[model samples]
Target: MKTNILSLTAIMVVSLQGFSSALETDAPETITSMGQIAEIAHATQEFFWQLVPPMDDPLYIHPDGIVRAVDWKKFKNKDFTSQMTAEMKTVSSSMYPVYRLTVIETRTGELLWHNSLDQLVWQTPAPLDYNPYFFAFEHWNVDSTEALDTQNLLWGRSSNVGAEILLLPEAFMESYEEDVALEAEAAALAAPMAMMLLSPPTVTNLMLAIGVESNEVEVGVYFPSGYTNPVDVFVCSSLMDWDWSLFTNVSSVGISEFTWIDETATNSSSHFWVAA
Candidate 1:
């Protein structure tokens, strides 16, 4: 009886060990792939583009047809989180440091979105950090059709912190509307229409302080940089029907400054002026 009991105990112990070995053989993997990280980065960009309104939306427009300044916020949430198995962004470290990104809208100059990922174990070696990058903007084409600057992908890095970035709007103007406002103001002042006299305003070669109407186009003449003398101006219109001779309100605000409305040059697309 004693022998039989010992034999049964031994069999039970062997059975339990075998079952544990089977479980170990069927264990699930915990590692992630580099491709998976890239995919997540891609998805993050698409997700971000959906949050903001288009560039031409009236919210961004000012009364003067320039873009207004506004703050950026996520559509549904103030903050967001994502998980990615990214590779090491740094060259020396084999350890992949997950990055936190603060995305700014270049058009509005607002911090619109932010996201970060926590590190994960990998089965296969992952290459390159898969952080999100997004870029968006409006395209101004000579024609009415929409344009795209698809040459480069959106990316940013601090090198020190290993942070990356994403741009939104898919297209960007060379300058923001606010930037345009400042540029237009400066251009109008420097233009020939703003000249007060044909000579330097001051011995220090001061900039002329004459008034410049934003609506009028100033003809450009090749004069010395400090010279402010007025030069003859000529105008052109893209519209074949525009008649410059019919304008009767030719007027001057300064000694040689002159401005006239080419009534037929109604749209910006049709009006162009230069020195005669």
Candidate 2:
């Protein structure tokens, strides 16, 4: 009887090992919903890295040839607030079953903000622009014509590491023409400048990288800095549609006579003034 019991115990151990192996091998090939969102965000970040200058490269030079770049690492390791998380959660709540999103910082990999595509509050009630949804905090100077034009600076790191310069000259022109036409039609009405620099379609690339069918059909610019305070915003979609000539003209002419235009429309339906 004792011998039989020993044999039974050995068989049980082997059976458990086999079960564990099976579980490991069959571990669902499907990506989790959260994983998909994270993957897209990661892809966007990588794209930003490719567009900007190398960390050691100089972004600008003075008459004496001084160089600079934005160092984004400075904003690392910060904690997320409950309110920010709630805002992101609201966005996620809207897009049930289909997709969910989470917001996190690039520096320390901390989830500072997040929301689902469904929870986003669309004031205009049009199809959602993915760029603004992902990067809600980004902002930039509307009247910094020189920065927008000659500087070719798009998103900058706090430490001066420059990335994603706007090179599309045509997009700038189209934006300028549109703004000018709108102003003319309005007859002294103020309108915010439509021109914005953005990163390429990294989100799509990211979806491809992860080997999943990305539901994220469209992309847009994400300004981490809100309209009130200007910071470098990321460009992902509508980049090809922008008019680059607007920047060129501004860079050539300077902002001495520049006047304040209308404020930019916020994701929350607020407005921030812009100068030209």
On lDDT, the candidate that comes out on top is 1
Backbone clashes under 3 angstroms, per model: 15, 47
Name the weakest run of 10 consecutive residues (lDDT summed) in model 1: 4-13
Query: Could you give candidate 1's per-residue lDDT for residues 1-276 as a string of tens digits?
Result: 011111111000111011111101111221133332333333444433322222222111001111112112322222222332222332122232323333222222222323433232112222344222223232122221123332211212111111133221111222332334454567557764433222223333322211223444322222334445434443444323323332232223233434333344334443433332
How do the residues 144-251 of candidate 2 rate in per-residue lDDT, one tens digit apiece?
334343333333332121111111112233443344355454642443332222222231221110100122112122222222222222212122222212211122
TM-score of every prediction relative to native:
0.17, 0.20
lDDT of each: 0.27, 0.23
Q: Candidate 1: which stretches are off by over 4 Å?
A: 1-230, 239-256
Q: How many backbone clashes does candidate 2 have?
A: 47
Error in Å for residue 262 of model 1? 2.6
